[model samples]
Target: MPSTILRRAACLLVVLAVLAALQACSSGDSKTGAAVLNPSTLSSTIPVTRAACTPFGAAPSVVQAALDGALNPSCEPGGEKLERWADSDGTMRDACLFEPAAASTAHPLPLLIYLHPSLVGTDLSLDVTNIRSQLETADLSGDPDRPGFIMLAPYGRVGTRYYPLPDQDYSPGWDNWYRQMLPDGQERRVNGTTYAANVDAAAIDHYLQLVLAQGKVDRRRIYIMGWSNGSAMATLYALNRPQIAAAAVYSSPDPFGAFNDPCVQQPVVGKPKDDTELQLLNPQLPIYHMHNACDIAGLCPNSLQLRDSLASAGATLIDDHIIDASLKDVAQCNALCGTDPLANYAGLDAPGGYAANLPGYAIGTVNHLRWPSSRTVDLFDFLRDHPKP
Candidate 1:
């Protein structure tokens, strides 16, 4: 064959090779035929296996100390292992994880992150709420369809302030919100910009990422709950993370900075600038807010205002229930107390101790500390029904 003929044959082969390479590249695109060649698809399909958490031995003592308001407290819930992760600021943070035996990659459990209140840590919160028991019951129920949950209770950093109510208790608080008194005495609001710089928020985000990496979490059913100040944290977290399925809180303070003169008198709710601030909350997210009638911080009015505000913003679903705290009926304890009417109020200062017995403070503290009685509402049922759509 002539040289020209050989060269023409080589050119034809090179053109075919180029066309084949182009076809391969096109197929690699996520929008094209086979996702096998796509890097995104490959990464997504690969099963992630994180090492099982090591069990922390000193769980019981830590719990008791927290309940008694010990000067130094560390969070380690009973039977649950402590998980430590570094914050964005490189400070190590602690979390207690209660993973059900049924939790596996094949049967991932719904993840519920519990944020503790101002003064106490994870152990006390879990103890008082009895949420761990509830989860255990569900897991051991022998029902395949209703697998239990994996709870991750992350510890908030201890605050600098010395809280002096019902005797001095060490305060471990979240940076999600901070109250500031306005110029006109008695009015207070959460510092909008300052609270945004929350380091705990960053740490909580990292905590979530670590839990998800374990492969035993159902991402769609991720929920958060909090009590008192922690409830405020939950509100901010849900707002920041729209992917959250729902938020169920107890005695949340004014999250929107709308309430003024809290606890001093009847809190007055004022409108936020425009509706933009209020609309930041995902309208589709289900919120179950339970507040006691006579709360110490006067938070009931705040809950009512938030409910009305969300409604005006076209929120898809929000359940707000104000439990009647006036009646200390043992019947209303919902088995939280066994034959003793005051069992629900255990560990708290007795009725006449210090200033805690001041009128409403007697039973008011009990009502605030206790969860909404199951007779009034079922929080678990609400959580089970609402997954991220």
Candidate 2:
């Protein structure tokens, strides 16, 4: 062949190789194709993974002690109190409240309200011992003052999930709602409401009001954190109440349709259910989401999309941590594994804790990476910077 013909052929081969390389990255490796996060100047993200070993060990006492240290001198760890408040019908609801030593009416403090997961075993209250244990390992506790913060973990009224509504469920709104049992044996209905009063939203609201009344709450710094289904509910609750400063969610998909908990619902009939509504209430609401590439729930994709949308709309901040576990695939990630579960595995290995060995992560397990991936970033530290205006 002529020299000109040879040059043209070589260029064609180079183009093909580049195209092939691009295809490989988009499959599931790179957060490029279908990525919901916007790389614009407004929003930013820094990916980080959990520690090398399981921070929460097999021993319950050890885990508790570790959590105690994480919260530090302001509050003694391992101790929890059950707070009971009146429901709409004048009945009582129970939740676990954690108070730092600095919590006093004279000096206001930030409040962190946590919602439990969708799955419920024998216990109906927040999995403080387990989930919060992870937070301890991550050192992701609140700090309103020098070394203190306020945390409230509320139990779910139906199916152990935060039923989305600003108040307790009444007859007309939940009048036509249906009822059924969630896979985890909790009773629930997604038609907005049912027999069970939705104190998840209402109860938390009432508690906030009570705290405000007590004059110990720094109203501008109030926030919420939830995992799995509860994470979705966090956004739902934020939609109704714009006063909430920020939200930190994990495992729940960013997009509205990642995982379907037909039972987890919005109790208010005419209330806003989509992003359009969320934007109207709080334009600069800061949200930090932990999404794993290995999630069995298929929540990462939508979560990324939502992150982008939020950034585009001028959100105060969107910390989208996309975890990538190359070896853990859809089937492998979703397997009935966990024989060697890591720190604070809640499903099968609980109360007693799990084997320190990992990779055989907990059921519905996704990427094990939690917390900000960068060595310099700390979630708890970042949270303190943003106080509501």
Candidate 3:
């Protein structure tokens, strides 16, 4: 048997080795055959050009004004389209509220939380007209057959990157907060941009808490949808929070290597070691994952992996459609997959085939990133069928 000091030294070596492996995977690069990011040079905010939000106008400002008008009905008392809620870290977040035009007095309506991609914050970051046009094309805003539902799209912090530090601390020159963990299992406040402990999850919880207090929401019928980074966050939130009945995520990556914590024994992809800080979420949350085969940001394979993970946890995999570049083929693909293909494959001409080899998941292809209106309808239908118990 080894002495106590030797045992401790061995444990330290094992921890260092595991951390080194994880660092390499997270950074997408490696040094001396080890993957890791330069911890000392970590910055909170990365510069990203704000997406254009022009709607029926040449200038961005004009489009923003139009979006404001659409979201905030002129007849409302406050004349405010959004209600703001603060998180634990004192960050004031806003959510756009869309009340149904003719809600029945007896039935409380379902709520759908829409999370935008990491380009610009708010619904107006992209061309307001373009976004609105897309929503209209999807039939999400004006659907006569669906239940009366309220839509809320919350704005995340305006930064290109997200940090997953152990706790929250403020640093000058960095707009976001970070948390640091000491060697003794104590959390310390470090000055700089650190990782948020599931900032998306915390933000949703904050929004839900505030909405519930208003007494207009049906607690069992909350649904979520997100794009890109927002999509990944949405999936994470649904997996961890039982209140969410269903979720839709598009073009997102895995969350395994992003954080600095150890893994928890839930239901993750690989057989992650016992010391990892990432937890395996075991809830049976319904999820709709959409991705394009040629997605430049997140590869289609990653989305398949996520779908497989969800299925392993007993969640229903409603449908997975892959988009290629051939229009004719895309139509055929949608017909075969029982979902639309042209919506996400906006530019491509549908040539690629479905990634059917992905384990424990369904796969399809489209030409681009915009999923069809039918896909959205299917997701909402799934949410309606699986109310929270």
The candidate that wins on lDDT is: 1
Candidate 2 lDDT by residue in tens digits, 92-183: 44555676566687756777777655443113323333434433233333442334557766554432211222111211111111211011
- Model 3, span 21-126: residue lDDT tens: 8865775422111123233442223221223211100110011223322332121221134566554445455565555654334445677776665543444333
lDDT-based ranking: 1, 3, 2
Error at 42, model 2, angstroms: 30
- Determine which window of 10 residues in candidate 3 has minimal summed lDDT: 53-62
Instruction: Note the Cα lDDT for every prediction shown.
Output: 0.53, 0.43, 0.43
Evaluate residue 103 in candidate 3 and report its C-alpha lDDT on the 0 to 100 scale. 32
Which scores greater on lDDT, model 1 or model 3?
1
lDDT of 1 by residue, 1-389 (tens): 69999999999999999999987777442211112222122111111121221010001101123432333234444445456665444455677777767778888788888898877667776766667776655432224675678887877765432122431234576644332211111121222211122456555666676678778877778888888778877876675455577888887764544222111111122222322232232446688877766554334555566666556656544687666665232212222112121111112333323242233345556667776545322566677678765
Deviation of model 1 at 331, angstroms: 19
Residue 124 in candidate 1, Cα distance off native in Å: 1.4
**TM-score winner among the candidates?**
1
